[model samples]
Target: MFLTYKDLSELFPNSRGIRDINLPFHTISSFAEQNQPKGLFIPLSEESGELGKAIENGAIGAIWEEGKEIPKYTPNHFPIFITNDIVKGFKEMTKQYMKKIKTSETKNMDMTKFLFLEEKLLNENFKTYDIAVVEENLSLYIEQLSEERRG
Candidate 1:
């Protein structure tokens, strides 16, 4: 969530009387899914239906297609980014966000090994389990990996 309000403003430079947004947004998401509070909402549809949903779900900012009639009820202060191509606007925003994120590769565990780990932990049966403890599970996982390497 490295995105700042300045970044958003730069992404969609054009707007109607929306100079500064009061609340800062942490994430950008579509209108369909309700993200956490303080999200910048982008609609898949040209229709205004999703705009209302965004508002209800606590979207601090929005992207509106340029030349599309702005809704009368929309507050003057609400930051509505105006872009020629709404779809491309959001897509570009997503692309920028993707670049900022750091992704890690994961090893896919075999089902038998997964079941063995589950069995071992189930005996201890803590109500809240965060994959048990790393120290306790590391040896078991290493043993399994060594077997796989041999096979």
Candidate 2:
């Protein structure tokens, strides 16, 4: 999650593009702020100093661009993922992780069972209804699971 300055430059190539980067969840001030240990993104720029700051702030790991020398200030314990383009690598990694999460969520849920329940709830007019209710229910179920996991 941590993006070094060099990584950002190589991956995004445009400074303006870096500011527009979006992540799945809320981007908090510190990675440790989340309940679970998450990835950190630090643009390895001379000015920001987020890479060093993040390490001091409890970031577990960072993504560094390949062919770029690691900054002398980088700490030893913070693991780094060296890639050709840090931003692209971060996006791809996040996408793959999200897909895995979605896949796992639906793995044990029977589509037929869900359909049957929907039909029963909406009667024969189920075709006119959206799946918002189903999605909400699933979301709640996932939230409960996440809470349980955290506990």
Which candidate has the highest TM-score of all?
1
What number of backbone clashes does candidate 2 have, counting pairs of residues 3 or more apart or in separate chains? 11
Residue-by-residue lDDT tens digits, candidate 1, 92-144: 65445444332412234111011122443335332322333422443443344
Tell me how many residue pairs clash in candidate 1.
0
Name the top lDDT candidate.
1
Q: In candidate 2, what are the lDDT values of residues 25-140, reduced to their tens digit? A: 21212222222123454342232245655555545455666787776776565455567654446445434434444555444432211112232233333222223453444344
**Backbone Cα, N, C clashes tallied per candidate:** 0, 11
For each candidate in turn, give its C-alpha RMSD to the true structure in angstroms.
15.5, 16.1
Candidate 1 whole-model C-alpha lDDT, 0 to 1: 0.53
Q: Candidate 2: deviation at residue 150, Å?
A: 41
TM-score against truth, every candidate: 0.56, 0.41
